[model samples]
Target: MLIGEVARHSGVSPRMLRHYDALGLVRPTGRTVGGYREYSAEDVRRIFHVESLRSLGLSLKQIGRALENPSFTPSALVGDLIRWTEDRLARERELLGRLRAIDASAPAGWQDVLRIVELMQGLNSASPARRLQTVLARPEGVSVPVGLLADAVLAESDPNVAGALRWALARSGGDGVAALAAGVHAEDVDIRRRAVLALAGMSEVPGVAAALADALGDPDPTVRGRAALALGRRGVTAAVPALVGMVVEGSSDVDAAEVLGTLSQDPGCAVRITTALVDELAAPAADSATRIRLTQALVELPVTSVLEVLRQLAHDDDPAVALVASAWVGVLDERSAEDRGDEDS
Candidate 1:
């Protein structure tokens, strides 16, 4: 085959084939009468081999070594090629993700596209400060993509940065709730915690509320407690049992008590929460510490029944419980006296 014919048959451009020959990766083995390059069958076969190696992402230099070095085993070269291909694939995947985020944002101009890209890069930066600034510094009218924020929120390890990202997601509204919900179901406890944290900070979207409600029963106690706390603050009475448990258990019991007080503003919730607390108080396993916490929780409830419960608790066998409950009784007495004074006036 002549040069042009070989180029035509092998789909190698004539100029590239010449370059390949100049590099000695592939060379025609014969010359025609006109001194035009001519390829023997062996040379054509070598060209095919070179093209095949090139297709596997081998640099031309590497291909030359592979073809010429009899001692060069393919195992090492193949391993290197795998690593290179994986790196290229990773870069391509990252670029594709960035493009998708930009597309999702529906940027109207190149400047908008570039701004979104910069925000994404900053969020993914190695520096926690950069990530936090990326979220906190987003200019007005330049909306950060929620998917990118979702990814960052799930993966962020730095506490300050994570808090900032959660804040940004909350301001983004319900856009990332589904993504955060998926994180709630992640096998990683940390990721589940982060997801719950982000969901808790988010505005009250129905889906986010539902996700939080489901999380109230998470196998992880931390997850359960956090979810219950968030739901309770939002007045979801489903968290009543867990919130009461937190109070009796003395874990975030202060906040738990406050939320319970808010929940008790409704008469029905008051009865349910009071019943739950009373049940904990009367448990045979209730210890002195548990009894004290339970006693303290009653002070947060303004229901008239609180006085009777405290009066009954004020006589408990545990001196600590008696002391705390008796103190609360006096506190309640002062309020009743003040009310009478107001009424008399």
Candidate 2:
């Protein structure tokens, strides 16, 4: 057929036919005596195949490869195509499941649900960490919807889940950290304590510091002590104020004393903070046993400032406080001299 006739029958424009001919994508089988282009039945079939492949998103190069070899199985090509489609559909189904869960929830307590939906959207767009971080930021005691919790639990099992969660947590805001911090108030003290410890290890959200600070006041001595230790582990200067308050308040409770001792050993803690703690322990109002425990903590740090703090404590009215402080000061002095010698060498 002539070019115009071929265009009409094939549903391709005349201009496109010419362009395909120029690119050698499609060519005439023969020419008339007057030089008019002629397309054979086989050429028409090839044109249909080309159009079909193009509609399926195959590039011209891919179509050429397929057509060049008639021995290539259509079933093989179609199987490959179906596999790609199925993979994409699976991901879409996961996203839809998350969305459906969110839509079914009431607004009054749907923050976690909404967050889950947002995370699913992120994953649909190939982001998973942003979702995990959102989960980590809820306030202590606030329970995320069961669905949202399940999503996080499932994410933990995914190989890529950790990387995404870490990235998102690193960039999380105060509100997000607060949510996770609130987990400290959960009725399940063990769960709450574990959550608090996890949050403390996270360097991403600054809000964890505030949460830890508040946890020190928990009615449960164990919770309060854990919070103090978490702050100390984090080593943020901001926590120094809270730690000092805990030391001076002198929890009569053994757990509280243990927590105070842990905070005293924090590497990030400054000399001045330790000194104030020592002074508090030496006060006439202070308990001699607590002073002894505080002295042990000062010994653990072994810094010059800590030694100085201990020296001040050596004058305590309690003979045991003075004796323990003096012993620790001698050990600290020896350690400091050795450290200086190493530096000099």
Candidate 3:
């Protein structure tokens, strides 16, 4: 095939193909007298393999080395990559540790100052924005001192770094460490929201779980909804009863269907929770699309109770819900047959 044909088939641009050719990454199989490159099926396969390796975080140079060496073991290469990732994570943890120590100092009103320092450190990397994002992902309370330092870094860092820091902090689940939880219960809605999310990430922390459970009653539905998601994501079985209530009580402004769908995937969640989800699907006011989504989520659950619930939805008044439920029932029927066959053999 010609370059355009290869580009169309592979979803890689012709310019990138030429670059790869120049780097001896995926050379054309032949050339015309006039010099146009021609790629064979084998060459296309090689290009696909190169793309796959790149997706696995291999550098072009590293991939070239692996491809050139017939004896190269993919398992060894993956092990080496894992080691590299581990080392990088260790270094980031160390840097975060230093930032936390800085934040713990007795400096008066040093929140902004500490964040500025952390942001400055983040910008020193090749992808400053991405590095700053990594710093912000540190779980709350687990790294309270780190969160404070990130706050301090954000306060005085370069405007670009500060922006990245803010985005990261927004996603940070400030739950685990005591230092992070200090101001979490503040009267401010935004503060409570951020704190609740951070705490949610700290599900193992007793106080974090308490905070999320309490936030379920917040006047702001958005906060309550997010808290519901946080609890579900944490797989807090303790919160399943409350989440079931949220689904039925209808106080939650957030998509109760979606939250219930999430809870269905929790291995520790009870059959009663899933039963509540099925009941919601039966509601006349429920959107047909949401009902379909709930049915699909139920199908993914391993609990046998899901089979009965799906059967009930398979006859739902909404055609979409019935269709989705019917499809899942067929899949389950097929899986059950296979399991029986395996046992017999």
Q: Supply every candidate's count of residue pairs whose N, Cα or C atoms clash at under 3 angstroms.
A: 0, 15, 18
- What TM-score, computed on C-alpha atoms, does each candidate reach? 0.71, 0.41, 0.46
Q: Which stretches of candidate 3 lie over 4 Å from their true place?
A: 1-147, 150-184, 202-206, 241-269
How good is model 3 by TM-score? 0.46
Model 3, span 245-325: residue lDDT tens: 454555451455455556666554546677666676777777776566556656656636688888877887888888888
Q: By lDDT, rank the candidates, best first.
A: 1, 3, 2
User: All candidates' lDDT scores?
Assistant: 0.89, 0.63, 0.66
| Residue lDDT tens for model 1, 1-345 | 899999999999999999998998888898889999999999999999999998999999999998999998999989988998999999999899889899989999999898888888898899998888888887887888888889889999999999888888888878899899999999999999999989988867769889998888788878888999999988899999889988877888988999999999998888887888888999999988888888899889974858889998889888999999999999899998999899999
Error of 1 at 192 (Å): 1.8
Residue 206 lDDT (model 2): 61
Span of ten consecutive residues with least summed lDDT in model 2:
146-155
